[model samples]
Target chain A: MILDSIQRVLSTNELVTAFLFVGTLVWLSYLISARLTRGQVHGSAIAIALGLVLAWYGGLVTGGNRGLADISFFAGVGTLGGAMFRDFAIVATAFGADIKALKQAGFVGAVSIVIGVFVSFLIGGIVAISFGYTDPIAVTTIGAGAATYIVGPVTGTALGAGSDVIALSVAAGLTKSVLVMIGTPFIAPKIGLNNPHSALIYGGLMGTTSGVAGGLAATDPKLVPYGAMTATFYTGVGCLLAPSVLYLGVRALL
Target chain B: MVIYGVALLSFCMLTGVLVGDLLGEVMGVQSNVGGVGIAMLLLLVLSNLDSRKLKLTPITEKGIGFWSAMYIPIVVAMAARQNVFSALSGGWMAIVAGVAAVAASFALIPVLARFGKGEHQ
Candidate 1:
């Protein structure tokens, strides 16, 4: 029965697997969060556990071929979402912040994600067309998971075209993760961008841009700590709802 | 404070999931757990926050608002691929879902904000 269940799960498409991974993460996150809330666990433990699980599950899902990239992409998305949500919370709760601010932030974050995804799609399409590629024009959902987790792989998948998009996305996500880790802190300080919230946004944009850039330069591992948190949070939210939401949106338009 | 943050987040998520599930069961609506979690968290956080600082520069506020609106269309456009409106029996159902999501966020924020305040008093 156990073996059967494992097979059933593995045989399913990437979306179902993505959902299962997220659901598990959410549940684990809740457990960790609960422990922290009860003063039973340190925040560092939570962070470590998150990183470890991310690495492990990411490897498991993407396998040896694209595991690192997939892990990085998903982690990036989650970190971005979490950071945005955290900012919204902080703004909403801060003595000087208000409903308008909260509303505005939420709006901005959501819109940014939409714009980002659309832009990525447009770029992917143009690249495919200019190169005389014959892949499906529709945004590939398989890579979306990797893209949400690891931006590089998604970008790779986008530019790599058709059959190898998954592999390309995975490769890209890993490379981007490394770059963002190295660059965000240094760039942030130089650019006068500070604070955890801003750091999160900066990290996300870096991850996104790195995915666009592919494996150009070596990324720093230190930024991984910061970017991982935000990426996981956003990726979690997006992965969970993207399919249902996308389905609804497309149906309405057609 | 960290413990409290974790506990509150957990409670909000659990409550949101439960509430969303109950509502889904009763109404046959397909509300998302994450959305509920977000709404609940917002409510809890906002309620405990001081009301005086709810301000931002107009430009910043506008930027945020625009981003928030941007997600809706992407989600809607993607959802359209699934024939979501037809499943709802009409476009009105989709509108209703959108309205409910927005309303839930707005209503819960203030109500939760008040509840958090009452606890302190």
Candidate 2:
């Protein structure tokens, strides 16, 4: 009787159910990572890994378009994870940020973002070209993906690039994200990655908000705000430059 | 008191959305522009206002901190839901681009760190 009522409620309120399911999964993942990894792997990284496994499983089980959408109760995961809530979290986190530290990052911070985007685009473009995908639009869109995942799709859509190319760009960004998350803590000591100014510079250079945020949270929670500040700017700049100057320039060259 | 702080947070969030929407319109993006970034900047400004006009309580800070910490796991879950299957279907090009990009980014971390250390005093 109780199970039937619970299912009824879950069906009636899909978004809430989705949140509950995700929350439970994240909690369990955190426990496993903490216990099994002995804190060597960050819980956020573990949670993300679990999420991917579950998504792949969901796809195989349901043959649905979305990863978790095969199950009627979890279909709302798509909406919950969309830009709206994504933006909401981004905005909300801003409240705790220390703007003074962000300002202190100064000229190096700005320079890092410029160099980061340019270098990432160059690397991505080279890979795309070498992969036998030489179309200028494909190259540019994929290059923007290297800058950041958000830039990948925005640039792809703006340039009217193919779905395959856009999807590839996203994959590139995700790979970058996972790498940054896993690598940040190990490298933190070597990079002298303490303090807010350095955090901002690291954020600008990394250019993956999820990666930077997760990595910083693991290394030092206090640094999340500063890193997120410049990382956020990196995304905006990437979106602006990728679709226009970057595309036109690539088009001219190739 | 906690309720009052929650109310303050909601107000800041709403103001952020409003301003972000306007900024997006001006930029021709027709929406939140950088979405969370814009809202965060707005919140940053609002967060500062506590000293002069708002005088938000410690609980408000606690409230904001709680939400800020929530971003990572949520982002992880969201990103997994969004992108897991793409590479699966997109073929070798996607996989190769992803692997190569990661390798390249890793190689450049030291170069990026050098720039930051140059500014160190």
Candidate 3:
């Protein structure tokens, strides 16, 4: 009777179960991070990677949308991983810095945004070409996505690219964001990303605000504002450039 | 006091989302634009309002501190929800494009740093 009751309670409280599940995943990831990677790779990065693996497996097994959240028991994963909490966490991280420090990197931040957008666009565009995506719209959309996830759809919609190509653009940008978040802490020392100015440049160059913000938060919370500020500008600059000057540039080349 | 911190964050988030949605509508995009970024800015501005009367208590500061460090779990959950496998299965082009773009951008950091004036380290 007690066993049946426990099962009923566990099954009913989905969100609680989700917390328990994600908590354990995080615990296991930290253990692996400490023993295997010797703490060189942050626990958060490992946790995210493991979560992605679980998501892939969940998709394979269920063959349903919403990833692991599709399973009844894991149904709460959808709400737990939804945008509301994501934005809440991001806002929490933003509380760690000072606005006064943001003023120190003005000119460098602007230059980084322009150069960052162009470089990412060039690299993404070149790769798209090499991969046989010869259409200017496809190349431009993906190239803008390489700038940031936000810019990708904005560019795609503005250019009237097909839905599939726009989806690809979003995926490309999401991949970039995850990569930046996971790679930041490991590369911080080598890149001299220890200051506000460098953080500003890094933010602009990286262009994805969430990626830069998360990466900087992991590496040094104090630098989040500087990096996030320029990264924000990067998206605006990308949206302006991608569908116009950048798209025209691609057309000229193609 | 802790409740106040949560209240402050909630207020910033609501305002940010509204502004982000408005901006998206203005820009003709169908999604909220820069909501989190705006929320962060709001928190920064509100917390540092430079008024002696408005200064946060230590308990409220601690409350904010607690939530700030809890971003890891949220990030993990967000990662779990992304359908990366399907996205990758679309083709090798998407993977190559993303990885190359981030890699090339990373490589340019030092060069850009040199041109950006003093690091003030």
User: Evaluated on chain B only, what are the TM-scores of all the candidate structures, in order?
Assistant: 0.32, 0.65, 0.82
Off by over 4 Å in 3: A1-11, A64-66, A213-226, B24-33, B119-121
- RMSD to the true structure for each prediction, in A, is 17.9, 3.4, 3.0
Instruction: List TM-score per model, in order.
Output: 0.36, 0.82, 0.86
- Specify the highest-DockQ model's number: 3
Candidate 2 regions with alpha-carbon error over 4 angstroms: A1-4, A63-66, A178-194, A217-219, B11-35, B50-53
Report the lDDT tens digits of candidate 3 across residue range A36-62: 989977777688778777777777778
Encode model 2's per-residue lDDT on A97-216: one tens digit a residue: 777666656677788787778778888898888887779999999998888777899899988999978878987876676567657776777766777777777787788877776677
lDDT of each: 0.34, 0.71, 0.78
Best by lDDT: 3
- CAPRI verdict (incorrect, acceptable, medium, high) for model 2: acceptable
**Which digits, one per residue and each the tens of the lDDT, describe model 1 over residues A1-254?**
99887766544443444434444554564577576567344322333234333444445555532222244324322332232333332222222223343342343334334433333333433333334434442233322322333432333343343544443333323322332322333343344333323323332323232221111111222222232222323433333333444424433543
Fnat for candidate 2 (0 to 1): 0.44
Report the candidate with higher DockQ, 1 versus 3. Answer: 3
Q: Lowest summed lDDT over 10 consecutive residues: which window, candidate 2 chain B? A: B29-38
